[model samples]
Target: MAEFTFSTEQQELRKAVRRFAADNFDEETVRRLMESDPRFDPKVWARLGAELGVLGLAVPESAGGVGGTLVDQAVAVEELGAALACGPLFGTVYLAIPALVAASAGAARDELLPELIEGRKTAAFAVADQAGAFDPAAVTLTATDGDVTVSGTVARVVDADAADVILVAANGSGGVGLYAVDAAAAQRTNLVTLDLTRPQADLEFASAPAQLIAGPDEAERVITHALQVGSVLLAVEQVGASQHLLDIAVEYAKTRLQFGRPIGSFQAVKHRLADLLVDVEHARSTAYHAVWALTDGSDDPALAASIAQATCSAAFSRVARDAIQTLGGIGFTWEHQAHLYFKRATTDAALLGSAEQHRDRVAKLVLDTAAVERVPEVAVGSPR
Candidate 1:
């Protein structure tokens, strides 16, 4: 097992992010901000990036960003997830940044990265087409390049309206290529998504002029790696959310009275809270392992990432549902923040890929390989 520890700088970053969350993500503030158009305040995002530099945590120093690592980015994202933050952080930083980083070096990479680092522009990666699986086979969108144009509809694109540019995965003559399109050129229709805090949009492109980021040869590899990065970070985000839910549920159990005594005194309520603790801790372990794998470039980061997503998604969803149950009627109520957390839990589970999807991937990677590796040779003459 690998050792786990945090640096002093990372600890300070945690404190700063916690303070930011407390001030900006208090229940009332989150509700107010999410209710607004765009679902996130640009000024607040600017402050988060240009001031704290959290958005630039994993960006290269040459891009005028904080010279930091993916673990730093994961730490910040985990904090934001605990707060149930409503912003462009997931779309811009987690998804789009990795896509840009994985693409071949070009003018678009040079210009756009600095813009995102400075909070001057927000970007979203087009994960899948209408079919909804984020693989090369699902990349049905086509691009023709007399002048490099993309056409097709991508459904459920995260933060589509909030983005200034979109990194589109489309089939081109060279093969599957990654193209960049200005948001202004594409038509966006807002979706009535489950999580209001994280809005999504359906985008329609009709020969929208685009800039090629990754050629056919590299596009598949680039998108696969970026999604792995997103899966790991999102697992950590689930951990943060699960821990918060567990804390609140425990507090409620301790104080909420039933049958002339605190509910926590009873065995059933105690068992429920205890189970949540186990789930939260398990989620933390898996999430952190994936982060380590990603930062260190482990032998099989994809397997680690898929396992983390599978474990954390189920854990967080259960934590949210049971926390709501622990709270009884209040958990089901609209005014309570428990439902908000539940919404985030369910949405995150299905956002990039569901728990079922990742579990299938995990089984394929582990079981298929084990079956092949376990084959033993028999002595032809000695055995009967």
Candidate 2:
């Protein structure tokens, strides 16, 4: 098999996204949008989809997308994460679009995919609860047929208030299914979230009209696949954020002086940054491996994803918190951009699943695989 390397096109795409983020996602613009009612600029989003083609970066061209690989999509998402972009990209592209594409072709997929790729509309995926449980049994909302009206509530839906449509997992007579509900038909209440850049909303529905995207038998498969794919992408995002935090902290250490000398000259500060550098680099390595595993149909994609999520989650959370400590007083202030990244890092650690959850999952997968293979348990991470 060929090595997992970014093509020139992918590298160029990353540069383009970075440039776009630099010009459009300045601190002032991000702060303003974070406090605004809509939370993001639609025109900029349209440009991202229509002009830059970031939204459809990985969608199959046959499905009216860019016909690129998942690596291409990751490149764009990482840049967005670094920029702390305030947009519907995470909910729409990562969650909703993947679910729609995975489901068998139908009215919802045929109609919504184009509009979504063109950035004319936005969507939210409510497959997981606040705890990040996405199993069929984890779903609470119930859907009934004969026009398919769903009743119940989906909590912690990313960008639910800004979504034109919501792809939800609900229990019905057909068992757990994926349903597409019109956002306007549901009650959307924005939450007081720690991460203002990535706003979330709670959605309540009382027999809201919907279309079944994927039925019981296939819903679980589709949902699990989406979750794993999302996990890999999310790990990549965490790596990007960690990189950003490290860069800022290192720069601050060099510039800030104490006792007539740069604080970076101090032994304690150097060790702190050196440790953070290891964490960030490990995060990037693990995340990239997971991305490769998923893209290449590796045997242990689940294991790879869990490991990546576990490592990246802890790494980003640590980097974000330590960045504030490194920056001293300015990092904790509301006016400084450090708080913004810190908030995002803290929120992201819990978004898909907590690091502890992922660590538990990784243990389960490794042990289960070992049991199947009848391999001797040689204490992992223990010296012989």
Top candidate when judged by lDDT against the true structure: 2
**Residue pairs in steric clash, candidate 1?**
none
Q: Residue by residue across 203-299, what tens digits does model 2's lDDT show?
A: 9989999998889877876666667667778889889889998999999999999999999999999999999999999998888887766665543
Please give each candidate's TM-score: 0.93, 0.93
At residue 169, candidate 2 shows an lDDT of 88
In TM-score terms, candidate 1 sits at: 0.93
Give the lowest summed-lDDT range of ten residues in model 1.
375-384
Candidate models: Cα lDDT each: 0.82, 0.82
